[model samples]
Target: MVWKLPLHESGHPENELTAESDGAVIRRTVLPGGVRVVSEQLPGQRSASIGAWVNVGSRDEQSGHFGSTHFLEHLLFKGTKRRSAMDIAEAFDAVGGEANAVTGKENTCYYARVLDTDLPMAVDVISDMITSATIDPAELETERGVILEELAMNDDDPGDVVHEQFSAAVLKGHDLGRPIGGTPDTINAVPREAVWEHYQEHYQPETLVFTAAGNIDHDVLCADISQALKVGGWDLTPGVAPRARRDTTPIVGLGQESVEMTIHRSVEQANVIIGSTGITATDDRRFQLSVLTAILGGGMSSRMFQEIRERRGLAYSTYCFGSSHVGTGTFGLYAGCTPARIDEVTELMVGELEKMADSGITPAELERTIGQLSGSLVLGLEDSGSRMNRLGRAELVTGELYSVDESLKRIREVTAQEVQVLAQELASRPRSIVRVGPFGS
Candidate 1:
């Protein structure tokens, strides 16, 4: 009695078991065991990309288990019931493909890219890792040190530390503010049992979405997944819907006045991030914000680039960015400059943002940014890996999918007035400022 979910981007009744297309056929099926398989078929492609997206991340961790999510990510690849770590690695190497995984704020994905002929092996290896990992205590202890070393390496990078500090300051008192790797202290405290418990609870078939793109046949991929799941003894009965945690708490207090902090480091250059709260991932205003970001600091011709680097020669790198999560986001400018010019760089960066907000972008800027956004969007998806990511993220995170044409039309429809209104709102939000450099220079 499995049924397909709605296919039309707009809301529609769910009755059919599949949706068909000529260029890209998107198919979704709820396996008898509750696992949802969603994939796209591109007729002439040679390479295939597949991902196992789990709906859990660092933000979902309870107290005393800070780095458990990321810790699990490492252990999953260590070994499975039937394959040793080396065997798993060599399986992909034999197929001339690459396998890796990443832990995000709200989800974790294990993916592989391989020729279409080798997709079955890719599917089998990834599925085994997800469903049958041993999570051995000895392996956990070894990887714990590896993860700690990684964190220390991140601490040594000023740019990385400042961005992390900025997030902590802006998202103070919120789970989203914490680093994805969790602090070293928390990582050390997480026992092997806790890691196993987190995995069992969150890695259910009902909470996972399997996605593939490139020269793939959705039906074939689905069959392979069904067989692989059976190997791990996952029940193929109908399962429950994924659990949703809606966090609508606004970032309070920090938005009233600019909150500033500085970390003194004996670095050659000062890394600074001047940013404030912005829109969420699902907000309609995201399109407008995209245009504003590009115009302000997205490229070499952007205002931030021309003003800070080209004209004033203040920095070799200066750009603005916007990041959106489920309930909230941030928009900020980052610049690395000589320690002597820290004050001047901050002033100029802030001045440009104020000017843009106060007066809005010019006609030329709007048109150029729109074109740039349009090109970048289309160009970025010119591969199976990109398409696979788009499919996976849309299904697992956004819960909605957009055709390329639909996306381009939305970007083209953004108007100057829309950008201005959104820019003003962004500028009016409280700002969070972070600086990392040597003090008393």
Candidate 2:
């Protein structure tokens, strides 16, 4: 018997069986011009979720194109050459389906959920938006205001503001540090020509990945994508392969050390985020870090939760969070507490990190964290939308798909020693501290 590795995104054959386990069958098909289609079929599922992932994101924005990637995501659904915005909305509503788009640091996804029979329609509508958006000047102006309002809404939340500030401070000079939606200045300055140029340059067949799960036929889905894309004026030239996975080499001079800043907001509670540079998305130590994060502040029983909330009643919410990108990541702890308790909470948070760095999780803590992560990993994929998201991310970011059991195995294999080492490394890194509250100027 021979052991074979899973198929990767860059150079797999035209069609392949990517993974099969228990009752789910996952497959992949590469179309002309590097368009990739991946799908998973759950035998008994009646609902299907589909996602069209474009390889462009905020980090890909050029000098004048800041926020254009996310702005383009909004523009796509505004209207396409073949359908009006209202028509697009009604198409999904009439079928009782849900559709939306998400623009992240590294990619954008337009996704929908509907009955299995409506999968083709979902694909057609989303593909049309992706390929043939008119980017009408009037509609662009309208969406600009909407996005500005959206940004304003986010600014109103101290927690969101704090986290955004933390990223900007930590990643300081990096493109990844910029907000996904762009700042008000950039959004207002980004002319229509810049956005259209961005659209024409990045939204090519080689830069798109299509994925779906739940009652899907891989070949049929690929065909549907092909037909819809061709109708929308895409050139599906043969022999092209999908773009390679994101390079994981750490971007040079991208992180700042020991930076701290405070913003005054007229809020009763202070929101604080203390974080530092962490692991990349492809780093094998992500599993260990996952365990480490969970034990530190993942849930109610987590150390941060128990100590900060249950023991002292200092804060109503406390948690540790992390974000992993191609070659860099951010790890931090967040707590919202009364303004008077800000210093005390910050001290405790730093103290807890030092403790973990010095000593390590106990055997019991390790066991509980493994179980917690395993359960969440499996439970999060219980729906078709989650499954579709998993496929799209695997194909877009990591380039390889791991089965649920394989993912669980990796999580369970994380050792206490590994987690401690990761913690120590994280603690040693210079930290970035951000606070948002009504502390006197």
TM-score for each of the candidates: 0.94, 0.97
Instruction: Output the TM-score of candidate 1.
Output: 0.94
Q: What is the lDDT of residue 372 in candidate 2?
A: 90
Clashing pairs in 1: 32-236, 32-237, 33-236, 33-237
Residue range with the least summed lDDT across 10 consecutive positions in model 1: 7-16
Q: Model 2 off-target regions past 4 Å?
A: 1-15
194-214, model 1: which lDDT tens digit per residue? 999999999887777788888
Per-residue lDDT of model 2, residues 26-99, tens digit only = 88877888888888899999999999999989999999999899899899989998999999999999999999
Q: How many clashes show up per model? A: 4, 0
Best by TM-score: 2
What value does the lDDT take at residue 413 in candidate 1?
91
Query: What's the lDDT for residue 232 in model 1?
Result: 78
| True lDDT of residue 127, candidate 1 | 91
